[model samples]
Target chain A: MAKRSTVIAITVAAAVVIVGAVGAGVAVLGSRDTGGAAGAKGDTTVTVRVWDEQVASAYEQSFQAFEDKNPDIDVKLTVVPWADYWTKLRTDVAGKSAADIFWVNNSYFADYADNGDLLDIDKTLGSDAKSAWAPSVVKQFTRNGSLWGVPQLSDAGIAVYYNKALLKDAGIDPASLENLTWSPDASADTFVPVLQKLTKDAAGHTADDADFDPASVTQYGYNAGNDLQAIYINYIGSNGGTYQDGDRFTFANPKTVEAFQYLVDLMNTYHVAPSAADTNQNGDFSRDQFIQGKMALFQSGLYNLKNVADGADFDWGVASIPAGPEGRVSVTNGIVAAGNAATEHPEATKKVLEWMGSAEGNEFVGASGAAVPAVTDAQPVYRSYWENQGVDTSKFFDVLKNGTIPAPQGANFGAAFGAYGPILEDVFAGRVPVAEGLQKAQDAANAALDG
Target chain B: MKWTRTLLVYLVLLTGAALTLAPFVLSVMTAFKTPEQFARRSSLSWPDPVTLENFGVLLTGRTEFGRAIVITVLAALLLVAGQLLFSIMAAYAFARMRFPGRDALFWVYLSTLMIPAIVLVIPLYLMMAQLGLRNTFWGLVLPFAFASPYATFLLREYFRGIPQDLVDAARLDGANALDVLVEVVVPLSRPIIATVTLITVVSQWNSFLWPRVITTGNDWRPITVATASLQSQYNGNWTLVMAATTLAVVPLLALFLVFQKQIVRSIAITGFK
Candidate 1:
């Protein structure tokens, strides 16, 4: 009986696998009737992929407008979360199942462009289409003497979002906050003094007071931490130093080292900013503090604009990031949409891609205050939408015009960033000296780039 | 002296239980909170105005939380049924059948358990894509609905432990293999079968990575995939996340409640808990 039962179980298990496989095969046959790659199969449906849910609604509206205009062509937009976007896209591209049109960031596009996974924009749109958009954005997507994507939106500057009530209680002028300047030498710098003035102990003494206790700071004066984009990147570039020289990290530069040291000193020496422990443990520590009214000024990208706008109960305003010895040079980055080279319906995909690059399509996103559209003409609507929300978002644009630097970008940038990010954490945490950390980081970045 | 030892054991068990159940308790509490209430209050606090707005949003949102629940339940059912059927057959063959590679094949099959799923995803995904199974219902359930080594190993051992005298007695009565299996061995292996069924159901219900990778469209996306997508980088929508998490967990909790006796019986009989 036992032997017989074992045989029956084995037979049953094998039968189930066989049946499952056969079922899958039957489904495959049915799927083949839908044509290849998209909507209704043989009928013309173009798949478009994007990563941001905050802007997905706007894209859906934009795609609807496109579909209305081009009734023959159906567009399907899928929003992959930011975390899974690149991984899914990479696998899809490898499998030749990528969307007809999808987003391509500067750091990631080079591999696709190099491997001929992306459709050439120059071939699709021509010289006239290229010249109409922002010059820098056009330059960004241009790879191997051919443009690979159309820039949808650009994010370049970091503005200080200050709690109005915090500044008010600190007796600090909002106007003075805009031009606050930092230098390697504390006595020569104006930024540290402003931070010192804003910071207060539980015993009612400001950081400027000799009797002030660092242990019981009720409100932090500033958020200076390991955030490369909003904090250290601005400091590095604004101090006449650059984080990256082309593809290789150049933070070991004398001025770059000075910038890092002075910034680290704000936390360790002056005791104005939060410790590396707090910042290192939580990515959103500063933003949370600012919204909770524990922070005076939070310098960050417009990516957090919606979160701050919706979350804050206190009155808030935006000001340009503090200047260094040279000037306020915030790093700007852009998001672009690329057409898949391996798409089955090239002509249909091209038409969809063209619409994505058009101001008419981008206008939906801009008008809804989804993001700052790359099409210069559509930007006003985006600004006005935020203004209508009773928040002046013009500070980002204002700071963009003030000697801005491009965010670090190159073929091996993604790899290099993964290597150096943790190495610098030690420097920020005071475990490693800035000079030694920068040196080790430079080597690591170059090694990753070599690969 | 005996009471002291009992008290110590109770203390240890209570602590372990609290530690294990704390996250779920927090999730349930947060699910009832408004976004502002969640952010402002302590994690341990009761919701001042208990609301179901988060649940309402998830259920009605474009992701279609209701559809995900239905899909997950269907997949879990299919998976458990198929897995048990296949695992039992394979285990029975290995234990009692006289195939040439019986021992060799069993060892080989067992070795695959040591291989990581990550190493297999690419090739398996390619195979599924070639089979045109991606985004289909079967794609979500079929890859996982077969005889796993662990399942086969467990059942094979239980089958071997069945008495040879019982088999001889059944055969003496002119019982065929199928009749003997259905009437005798299957009845004797109830505890092990129940245990396998529970494990299969739980694993299938909570399966995330496979569903996320396989299903591009939400037509076949399970609740785990849907729950994960709710989390954005910037918006700390903890209340909404907790609601989705609580919703994902409720089915498993209900399943446990329904099968509590069988599960306990299986554990006691197997003596493997």
Candidate 2:
């Protein structure tokens, strides 16, 4: 009797397993057949992939407008979060299953263009491609005399975002911020003194005070750290130094070393900025501090405009970045929407791409205040939208009249960035001298590129 | 002296438990906070006015988190069912059935556990694309629906430990191999089976990388991918992120509550804890 019961139990378990597997298999396979047959029914789907969800939402409206104009073409927008966007795009492109249209930054597109994964914009759109978009944006996307993508969004210029209350309390005129200048030597440098005045200890003593405490700063005076776009790159450019010369690191230049020394001094010697130990690991540290009302002057670009506007409780205003000996030269970067070379529905894809390049279609982005549209005519819409919000955005566009220090260029920028990131962190932490760190970083960057 | 040792053990365990559960506690607290409160107050502070706005936005607004939850649950259920079924058959065969190269084959398959899932993503992605399965429900679940080496090895080890006498006695009663397996081996292996089911379901529920890579748009995206998309580079949206995490974790927590006894029993029986 016990044997029979044991046999029954084993058989029951085996039966459950068999039934579960078979049921699941049948269900999934049945659904897959329907799923497989669900494609290519009515309209030709031209998918557009982008990383920014905010921009994706804006493009949804823009694409809706495009769909209405072109009735037969259906546009689908895929928002891959920024972290995995590049990895997924690379994999999808390798498998020849990438989107009909995809957004590419300057750093990552050169490789795709070189690999022939992107369509030639010159052949597809002709002379209007050059004439219609922002000159800086068009130049960044151009490689070997061929344009690879349609300009979608441009980060106009790096600017300083200041908490107005902090400056007022420090007895520093906000207008003086617009023209503040810094040099390698402290004799003629006006920027450091303002930072010292703005920075305060817990006891309400400023950084210049003899009684001020360095270890317990209540408010940071500036954001000077390892950030390439908003901090060092702008500093390097305004000091008559270059970050990369045709895809090679050139920070070993005397001017670049001077900029690095000044920035390091702000954090270490002057005690006006956050410690490298904190800012080195957290990219959002300065921005978060500014939003939390702990920072006086936050140097960033148009990217953080919405963050500041929404997060800050106090009045804040924008000013141009402090000038170095050479003047304020901002590093401007732009994103372009590239057409896939292997897309099956090329004609429909071209139509959608053309519509994105048009002011009529791109204006939705500006209207929503998502980003500054790369199309020159649509830019006014972005400006007006911000003006309505009681913010003057001209500081971003005004500095662009001074030529930009070109954004990082190179297919292997990711690998090169990985190579130099740790070494630069060591330099910022005061473990390595600026001159020696710059030389090692330059060598590492070149080696990564060569590989 | 014994009480001292017991106190020390409890102290260490309490610390470990607190460390493990601190993040979940924070997630739940932040999920109830308004964005303003979350931004202004200390992270450890209780919400002054506990609100469901973040949850409302996630479920009802453009987030599509509701649909993602449904898709994730369906995929997890299907994958769990298939995995258990196939794993059992393979495990039983290796443990009970006399076949040439059975042990050798089991070890060879088990060796794949050392290989990372990322290394196989490209090849697996290519295979799915070729099968016209990309962005489909099948693409999301197919790669993981079959027998996992970890599952098979686990069950096979447990099956081998079952009393051979019972199987022989069942066979003497004119029962077939399937009958013996179902009536004898399976009844005794319920704890291990429950453990496997819980593990497989939890892993499937929390899966991110494969779902992120395989699915595009909102059609077949899972909860993990959906929750990730709520926060962009410039905006952390901690409240919204915590709300989404809270939503994703509730079902798993409920599952654990329901199966708490079985899980504990499995650990005690297997000497794993």
Which is the leading candidate under DockQ?
2
- TM-score of each prediction: 0.91, 0.92
DockQ of each: 0.29, 0.37
DockQ of 2: 0.37
Deviation from native of the Cα of residue A261 in model 2, angstroms: 1.3
Give a tens-digit lDDT track for model 1, residues A1-451: 5666676687678657756765564454346334334344345888888887767778888888887888778887777776678888888899888899899887788888889999888887775787656666777778779988988887747899998898998888898887688899768799888888888889988888999998888889889999877888889888898877766779899999999999899988888898898997577787777877878999998888887886788898998998888888887778889999889899999888888788888888777776888877777888889988998887887776767665777776778888988898899989999999999999998899899
Off by over 4 Å in 2: A1-42, B1-13, B116-119
lDDT of 2 by residue, A413-442 (tens): 888998999999999999999999999999
True contacts kept of each: 0.15, 0.34
- The whole-model lDDT of each prediction reads 0.82, 0.87
Please give, for residues B31-132, the per-residue lDDT of candidate 2 as tens digits: 999877766557899987999999998998767898788788778777877888789888999899998998899889999999998999989988999999
Which 10 consecutive residues of model 2 chain A have the lowest summed lDDT?
Answer: A32-41
Q: Compared to the true structure, candidate 1 yields what TM-score?
A: 0.91
